[model samples]
Target: MTLTLYTNPQSRGRIARWMVEETGAPYEAVILDYSTTMKDEGYRAINPMLKVPAIRHDDRIVTECAAICAYLAEAFPEAELDPRPGELADYYRWLFFAAGPLEQAVTNASMGVTPNENQQRMVGYGDFARVIDVLEQAVGRAPYIAGDRFTAADVYVGSGVMWYTQFGLVEKRPVFLDYIARLQERPAYRRAAEKDDAALAAAASGDQGG
Candidate 1:
């Protein structure tokens, strides 16, 4: 149990897999069933919220997807998955911004609640439209989220963007489309996806042989 990842390939756990793939680190995966996995007393101890995609890095347990991605990237520096020192500031800024505000806006939009102008003033993300505009401006200006290079920040933001784009949950703005194209083309991402896909296929076959 060097690093234990409790995940469901179909959930936010995929984000953790992306990070782990970027790190090029060795870890074990424990696929869980949707019906009973979360309720098992042992899994609850790993994440009180009974969330998927929890990680155990040796003795430290990290539950949230973003925290797990950020921590793993730094913990395995040889992987070079984090922003360079100069770009680190913007990296942190957009990473959490996307994780927080962008997520809220997406979820809110799915529920059919467009914010009023007055409510927009108080909400950090403003509205779904504004969130798209802001992210478009930043990503369009730089090749990657953190200036010139890909980082752990991209891993999180990219995952959110990619999913939203695929599901039509977010608008297919040029910036969003281009960003996902680039992220998906990365060798590391491709490799990780292949592994996860295989694991999922195997699990479906009732083998879980990996």
Candidate 2:
């Protein structure tokens, strides 16, 4: 079955679009308006949360950017975006870490909401500083998040790094700068960016016309 991606250009769906590009998958992009289309019943059925970036492949539906990235990588092994069985520990580890701890840390810090000491213990990310340090060290240790070879983990983690750095939510350490440089060099990344940018422009034009 042909894949269908329900997405908004400015949303987290861009990450999924990038993953699809990396997979070299032939997919249909359904661009939805954030305010109206996302709340529609049809889209909501695919994602109960009424979120963008949901994908339907055959009879299966997948939501969440990280999950979609992993799914596409495994689904299209000819793309070789995932690590082999023996080398999957780092792949799963960093991917989940980015989706969980790293994401939460950056979100909380961006909103100026630091957890108290007790709250920190209970929080999955511990503290923002610790999360930052661990992620920085992990990326610095290797060329890619899952080690030497680029994997789906990099798609998720690299998106986080790019967004965080762009928003000034995370410090632009040499490790992050170098990693992003490598990611930007990929043709898939550039194609994804251009596609989303054009979508965004079209949406803006529509708004103006209305």
TM-score of 2: 0.96
lDDT (10s digit) by residue, model 2, range 10-34: 8999899999999998998999877
Q: List, residue by residue over 21-89, the lDDT tens digit for candidate 1.
A: 888878888888778877799898988888799989899999887888789888898988777889989
Q: What lDDT does the true structure give each of the candidates?
A: 0.86, 0.90
User: For all candidates, what are the clash counts?
Assistant: 0, 0
> lDDT (0-100) at residue 206 of candidate 2?
77
